[model samples]
Target chain A: MSNAAIPVTEYSTPQRGWYKRNEIAITPWLFLAPGVFFFLVYVIFPIFQSFNLSLYRWDGLGQAEFIGMANYQELVSDRAFEVSLWNNLKWLILYLLAIPAGLFIALFLNQTVTGIRLYKSLFFFPFVISQIVVGLVFTWFYDPTFGLLNVMLGWVGLGPINVLGDPSIVTYGIIAAGLWPQTAYCMILYLTGLNAVDPEQIEAARLDGARGWRMLWYVIVPQLKPATFIAFVVTIIGALRSFDLISIMTNGGPFGTSRVLSFYMFEKALSEYGFRMGYGAAIAVVLFLIMLIFIAYFLWSMFQEERGR
Target chain B: MFPTPIEKTSRTWQITYQTFLPLALLLWLMPLLAVALFSIKPEADFVSGGYWSLPTYFAGLENYGRVFFQSDMPRYLLNSVLITIPTVIGCVILSSMTGFALGIYRFRSNIWIFFMFVAGNFVPFQILMVPVRDLTLDLGLYNTKTGLVLFHIAFQTGFCTLFMRNFIRALPFALIEAARVEGIAEWRIFWYVVLPLMKPAMAALAVLIFTFIWNDYFWAVVLTQGAESQPVTAGITSFNAQYRAAYHLMSAGSIVAALPPVAMFFLMQKHFIAGLTLGAVK
Candidate 1:
């Protein structure tokens, strides 16, 4: 309104360039240019491209035919897809156990003792280590032939159970290995959350005889919402992205029972068998759709918070 | 404090808690302890089925020596270093600028732009896998550390921007406003006023990205094939394939691969946790 009221040629200084005149707005775009360009090229465009690619039949090296809905149609009849989807559901549900397990560990480790800092760091060791190493360590730990698990099973006079080789229990075994690090991640989040817990509230609750799980449920848990939310987000993403472990431990085997969507997509698209680019993109689309649900919820939550602020 | 601190607890319980702490830690770290034990054991022990027993002789030097000197582990480790460092530097530079823009300015598309980065960060990597690979291949960057680094920088910019923006938002706005009033250039305000204050955030992000990129097995496998370009996480699998059934050598290799990030965490423990739990507090 002010700029319209006063002529720019008469009011504005001639020495200032257009960039200086609109520095505030132009600077932001200038700053955002590289990051936005990179993100759009690599992350954003690829997403839409994946969605489009899923509708075609492409071998990745040859011509891509527009075969709309055929990939989805094949997915309906595909047993491997069924197993992968079911395993994804299993991963999503079971991976949430990390939150509670992490809370439990954090509560246990919350006390200040001599060398507690060292103890805390040591407890967080699994999370810091790469999942590949975790996979390898757990692979050896669960090894049937002279594995520590079988060794302990023998201590209890139980027969050796081949965890990775057994198709029925293979997914569960991988999930367990995944849980080890995930639990540590959650524990650390909760530990940090625990630190910022309002001491006065706790004291007041204590004065009212609120102790043990009662105080935790009503007071502590409410304060830990931020941590719980983060834990939930990371755990869900980690579960859905359970590729490296599967790739390392089982290679989607014992008849491909443990193939989650991410791993299965890689297998279909790029693995030695053949390049089913469209099929892989279709699998990836399904995974993305599943993720979109949670993404929407998260964005909505953040939006609400942003509006509140 | 929530558990009614052990200091106020019964004497016997305190004693029990003290003893239990170490025991719990031992049990929690049992698998890693097993690996550490394996890494130090002689090859003869594994052949004789002495997996659970104490080592007959210390071969820590020998096993790690083989990993460091005998295998393609060093090349893979160097590749990881090359890939990880450049990605971290690029993310830090790019996100700080984006973060500065999103944080300080109030624009019409601000919130939506912020959400885009957040949403993209949370998207499944598989969604971007095919195109990114094709793009990398087309660019003649396939089987190169530069490709991995480039993709990592781009992809990681999402989370880094989120973190950096929030960090910037928490800073005193008056400083930037003051700089502007004093006729400081906008970039000068960012460089002189904001970037100095963002050191802690950058430190936090550096360590976090270091760990993340170093442990990135998916992209390493997806983009690069051989030891020449693959990071240690992907390399460790091939390392295992080379020394199949040689648990000692594999354990040594695994330990070596996982060590850099672990060391980064411990050394930068405060910053790492701060970066990780950025949103967990508020």
Candidate 2:
């Protein structure tokens, strides 16, 4: 009995010692291992792979051949790429309108009244539903024959204009549809920011005889910087990621005028155009580079904040 | 407060603001309202071009019945449920663990690892498309619900971890320190102490992830195909293609596809907003 008890006690003590010695160092890795593995395999690794793939030539089914910047050279002269890039620029510019529009709406609704909570949510309804639904809704609304837009135009003795079919205006039409939901998102962010604004600052500004736009521009807007920054980041990201709506509404119709980088990449990679995997990868790389500029800024800012803390 | 409250303004201004509120909402929601109206209208109305006019008769029953029974919608919805529930559970579990590790510990690589997740979350999906699809194919998971669920869980972990880590950071560290002082095992402290406190954060992440996965159309199209595995978003798009002029049926399908997320949003409004506006306030 004494011998058996001694062994048990000895074994237990070392096991405890082992755990105690490495607990802080070992425990976190235990928690993080699965997540880090998945992220590296799926996200981080793919980024480098995509960049490497951009230098090769392949049809997705055949053996990939290293072409050493041939696809990138071709991209320089590709008319379709030009159109898509220009359209993306248009989308980026026009989509920024949502920030100011959202702020306007948020200010209008930032009141103390009965049923205001319900009103705020109702205004946010567009964002809750799927982009596919938004696409369909806007398509019907923009229909030349029986669309609400045309009906409203008829009241003004105006257009039965085919918005989607007109290449010159198609991107604008899609961006407008995109703005409906995006504006609501921005509005919510600003509303939250507005909630946290110091009442004393506003009172101080009021005592100094500030009012209206000046008051908003100087006092309120400065306080809303965090909201504005987030809105700006998300809006820029959303603009770059304009795929679903374009796919659903137009499919890059009217001679491929409304194509953005995202949709164009998909078309090259996997649509009826036949799979040009290498070329598609190159296109994706270009888009990634553009995004990297913003992401770098974002990360730098975040890092500064982290260090500050 | 910045704009000055409507009640504190003149009577005329208050009256005008009240009048303008509903009108603006109606205009903003007109497209959705139109779709809802179209879903209940009979086929004859679209044929007669009475799109704006009041429906001659309400055919809500027939349209919804046709969508549920005659189409591939039910299968698609089931696929969505299969894909989304697993994704939500996996993301929550993975993120919670990662978040706890990042939030509680002060390792040399903590901030770098955290930044990796934040940056990865914002990368355009196209960059991941070819590789992710190829990986799924290699694993024999192509065109499968499991495949979609796996990718979604991994991708969403980036955002979820960011959210959860920040949330846990905000939690009082004293509780955890006390648990350690009492000689609780590390894992047990996580389970018995921290896990229960993470309920609100978990609920918030669950709602946000549910909406994101449910409303996903791009990845659904890229990863899955046909009625067998495609979620409702992709399925409904194909449905629209097949029934080219069947506006009533198409509208009904869209509504059916959109209902779950809408219901989820209304049910978890506070959590949803809280999850979305994580860093905006401060």
Candidate 3:
């Protein structure tokens, strides 16, 4: 936060070289006003408002009642909340599968073959489309009748199955829809990373008879750490905030089996499930606190890198 | 280099690699290809049997015709364009100025403000949803494209500032000092000196912001209600609802809603990847 506070002292303090040199100065506030003002009202202020709203009960437009941590207490007992929380952990773990899937695709595409450029873009088409559309496509694919999945299953002499209608399979179905685009996203990231990988190190490894999985596990993976880190960050964030697919695919159904904290918060705060604003805010607060730990680490690492550069 | 580029392999293996490349790509893109095929299937085909096999009769025009003529797609597309273009422009300008001020000026708050913007960018949208929607309603900006644009620009500024500031900080400070030594006004230094150096950052951010805003579903739900101001994502939902039995039309609508970003990816593929993979190389 001190980084934001620095503009004032660095500009307004009397001892600066530029301050002494310029004949007259515009108000320092004039320079800082627009960005800071927007930050305060739109970004900064709403955060506190969310925190405050978590202390009360209000249904968007209704009268409010102060409940303090009562909303938080309700979260502890809500079975649906527990289910969503557990599913979110599954999402976080399963989503990392995209990182390696992406790396493998990236490595495959990194070859110097003809038509590889077209192949790369074709593989990337999923990431370009919005998740809502992806969900809709997957929903149709997963439809029990006249759908691709069932059609494929019929070939294997299996009965038609309702993937989205079964509670046990719904979260994985949605995650699979999500991974369609996510794996593409990670693939694109790693493709770029692989493009810039040092050739000398690989040549040295090759001379030592390193090849296949041995070379990949030892040399290539270490060089792709930054890409992996970024892929992990984005995948985790995408998984935790896995709402669009849930909303579009099944509305957290087969009995809210696909809900994550994001969709659950929306359902609690602003949907037909009844607007329990305080309770919703508490759910959001938990998600925020969890995300903060990752963000803090990301920023700390970024700062260290910045100082190094 | 990592896997031994396919060029140096044996001739037989090279032929195998070349043949397998397209096959792998086709398999990887099979789902999307299915969507494209489903989008063009005739109504009778869907009713007659499964969504497999090539359509006996093409209905691309008919399916697409129904999607546009029967749905609120035009209004939704308009809303997305209106909301996204200004946001791209507004965020680029605001972050450029903020980035300039932070990078060029060595003030006490420089690093702190930079990080605040970065940190704020990471906060979950849920935390901001209730308050932001309420704030929009209170300001009488709810259900309006302008309102959504304002919120997007404000939120996008955080990430853009981090990008813009880092890019600016990487430039030579001596250029600004040289301008200052010539008694150029400080603001002039920003306009004439730094702004020209900003085209690369601006280009990268533009394609990125366009895609992000185009795909935005969360804020679309919160800030805007009806088709008049709802984006393509929201457009997709109502299309999904009304065309419940019309799989062909729904598939067509999905394809249409997806075109702009897909087109953008193809056109700006280089810069798009450059922007997304920016900080991942260190």
Q: Write the per-residue lDDT of candidate 3 for residues A130-176, one digit (tens) a residue.
A: 98988988998898987788888999999999999999988988898
lDDT of 2: 0.91
Q: Could you give candidate 2's per-residue lDDT for residues B75-186 as a string of tens digits?
A: 9999999999999999999999999999887777888899999999999999999999899999999899999999999999999999999899888887877776676777
Candidate 1 residue spans exceeding 4 A from truth: A1-15
User: Over the stretch B97-184, how does candidate 3's per-residue lDDT look in tens digits?
Assistant: 8887776666556677888898898888999988889889989999999889989999999988888887888787778767765766
Candidate 1 docks with a DockQ of 0.66
lDDT of 1: 0.93
Instruction: Identify the candidate with maximal lDDT.
Output: 1
Q: Which ten residues in a row have the lowest lDDT in candidate 1 chain B?
A: B174-183
TM-score of chain B of each: 0.99, 0.98, 0.97
Cα displacement (angstroms), candidate 2, residue B10, comes to 0.7
Scored by DockQ, the top model is 1
lDDT over C-alpha atoms for residue A232 of model 2? 93
lDDT of 2 by residue, A1-309 (tens): 111111122224554676665676678889999998889899999999999999999888889999999999999999999999999899889999999999999998999889899999999999999999999999999999889999999999996999999998999999999999999999999999999999999999999999999999999999999899999999999999999999999999889999999999999998999898889999999999989998999999888876776
